[model samples]
Each structure stands twice: as C-alpha cells, then as structure tokens.
Target: MDFLPPLPLLIAFCGASVLLAVTPGPAVFYIITRSLAQGRRAGLASVAGVALGNLGNALGAALGLAALFAISSIAFTVVKYAGAAYLIYLGIKALRRPAEVRDAALGTADTRRIFRDGFLVALLNPKTAIFFAAFLPQFMSAHGSVVGQSLLLGATFVAIAALTDTIYATAAGTIAPRLRGNKRAGAAGRYVTASAFIGLGLFTALSGSSRAK
Candidate 1:
C-alpha cells in the first residue's frame, strides 16, 4: 500500500528514530529518575504511559493537523513555550522533593501515579505533537494515506523509544539501591535530577523545533 513508506525512506526513518531515542533527552531523564527512585517496574510502566501519549500526538498529527503546525510559526512558538514551562515546573518540583523514596519498589498507588505522570509529561509537551506533525510527513508520499502513514511512523518511533527507555531504566534501577542508602549521594541525586530537568526545559524554550534539512 502507498501508506507504507518506501524501503529506503523507512530505513532512514528507523535510523533516525534510533539515534533520537538513544540520545538522552527529557523523557530519558524522567525515566531514569523514576527507575532510580522507584525501581525497574515503575520505569517500564512509565515507558508504556509515555508511549501511549506519544501515539496520541501521532494520531493528532495524522488528522490533518500537521499542515496547521507547519504553516503557523505562532502555533509552533506557543506550544514550544508551553512545553518548556512544563519542563521547568517539573524541574522545580524535583528540586524541592525529598531525597529519600519510601522504598525502592513502589507500591501500587505510587506506581499508578508514576504512570499517570509519565503520560501527562509526554502529552503536555506541545513539542511532541509538533514533532510528529513535522517529522512523520517528510517520509510520506502524496499518494499515501496520511493517517495510515503517520500512525506507522509514529508507532515505530514509540517502539524504538520504549526499547531505549527500558534499557536506561534497567541500568539505573540496577544501581539505584546503592545511591538510595547513602545520604550524601541522595542529596547529590536531587540536584542532578533537578538540573537535568531544568536544562532540558531551557533548551526546549530556546530551541525551536526545526526538522533536519
């Protein structure tokens, strides 16, 4: 079907997605923190939630919203700013948070909270929606069904992201307990987490979403 991206385009897209996923970003930082504080299961659950949110953005982008995003600089700017603000807010919260977690493994209530927060983290970022709108269409052909093609590409991205994110979570979870005990390390961890979030936020605010040429 024309909805399927060409072999070459698909390959390129996959490669790009892998690179993007592997490169640590706000999402990665979020997953790492959750895993470090709450263990692997929480990290995985967060991954699922984030992926679902990303898929929602992809679906929205598929429904002819890409055109609006591409044509309107104002729209892009507003969303970008909003995302940055959210990230900064998250950073501030992280900074103010207690150094110690209740336990390495989260209880059901906390796990659900992590998952819900993960979903909102991705969903609230206008950058994600604009990113799907901007990035997926480049690989699509005029002859293809836009919705189908966008969904395919978006799913691919989500899958790749989930895999990479899990790897980070697992790795972080492995060492989380060590840091969990050391009070000094715990204090340091708080700053690191806060810095990561704030840095991502500032970067997002300054860097407008411009697709690769």
Candidate 2:
C-alpha cells in the first residue's frame, strides 16, 4: 500500500502546510486569546484541543474523499473542482474584507473547559474539513490507495499545524500583546494569506486538468 505521496508533492504539501499554519486565522486568534487572558497553560490546552479537532476534520475528509472516489471518478473530480472554487472564494472574501478578532473576555476556566472550548471551536468550523478535502487530493498519487494517501497527508498536515500552533501558544504573550492593535500588520498578513489561497486553488485546478489530459 503506497501511502506516501511523491517526494516533490510531499515537499510541496509541507511547504503549503507551513504557510497555512503561520497565517493568523480563527484558531490562532483563539489560542492567542486563551494565552493572553489565561496564560501559557491554558493556551497549551487550547492548542491540544484544536489539534485534535483538526485531526478529526482531516480524517473525515480522507474518508469522505475515498468514498467519493469509490462511488465514481466523475464524482470525485466534481468534488475536487468544487473544493478549488471554494478556496478561491475564501481568498476573494478575505481580500474584500479581512476578519477581525476582537478582544473578548474568556473568563478564567479550568484547563479542561478551555480545552473543550478550543475543540468545539475548531470542530464546528466546516471550512477546515473543506480545506482538507481541497488541499489533500492535490498531493495524492493516483496509483496509491486513496484512503492511505489521504490519511498520511492529512496526518502530516495536522502535525505541522500542531507544531506551529504550539509555538504560537508559547509566544503569544510576548508577541500578541500589541498585534491586535496593529491594523497594518494584520491586513498585510491577510493579503499574503489570501494570495496564497488563491494561488493554491489555481495550482490545484491547473495541475488536475493537466493530469486529466
């Protein structure tokens, strides 16, 4: 069972994962808030919860994609194109107006409750699952087992994200204090992330079409 993607695609996936991880999104903001208000311990708990939720999303995406592939190749291709369009839409929406994370009082809760909150936050966001569905297939090798490849790629991505999230959790107190107020920096980050998302969508669509031909 060939589980690993080709070396080049694996490297590309890793690079993309890093870029996505560094982008300040809902998870980042949630972790930062937990760290800022509750401390590193709380932040770490939050990170753990978010990582688990993301893992769930990845696994779900893998299974769902595999099922689609089993049902019909046409169905799978349709899903891939839909996912790409969704990514582009996300990028365009971000460009039009980046999301702002407002300061909210997350009252001091036990680490367990914070963990639960973080888990729920990530789990409930359907976008993450859609993202995994969109992004993982681009790196998959058609010759390999779809489920196996998807699982490996999904786990790899989740691991990278977890490592980056942990770093953010550890450093949030020092770095994030003034970050919320820096509109310029926030907007710049959003623009960069938006461009990356659009580029990824285009790359996926083009590569898929070329492969089809």
TM-score leader = 1
Instruction: Write down the TM-score of every candidate.
Output: 0.81, 0.62
State in Å the error of residue 197, model 1.
2.1
User: In lDDT terms, which candidate is top?
Assistant: 1
Give, for candidate 1, the lowest lDDT window spanning 10 residues: 100-109
lDDT at 48, model 2: 88
Model 2, span 52-72: residue lDDT tens: 877887787787833445456
Which 10-residue span in candidate 2 carries the lowest summed lDDT? Answer: 98-107
- Candidate 1 has an lDDT of 0.75
RMSD, one per candidate, in order: 3.2, 9.5
Name the regions of candidate 2 deviating beyond 4 angstroms.
65-109, 174-213
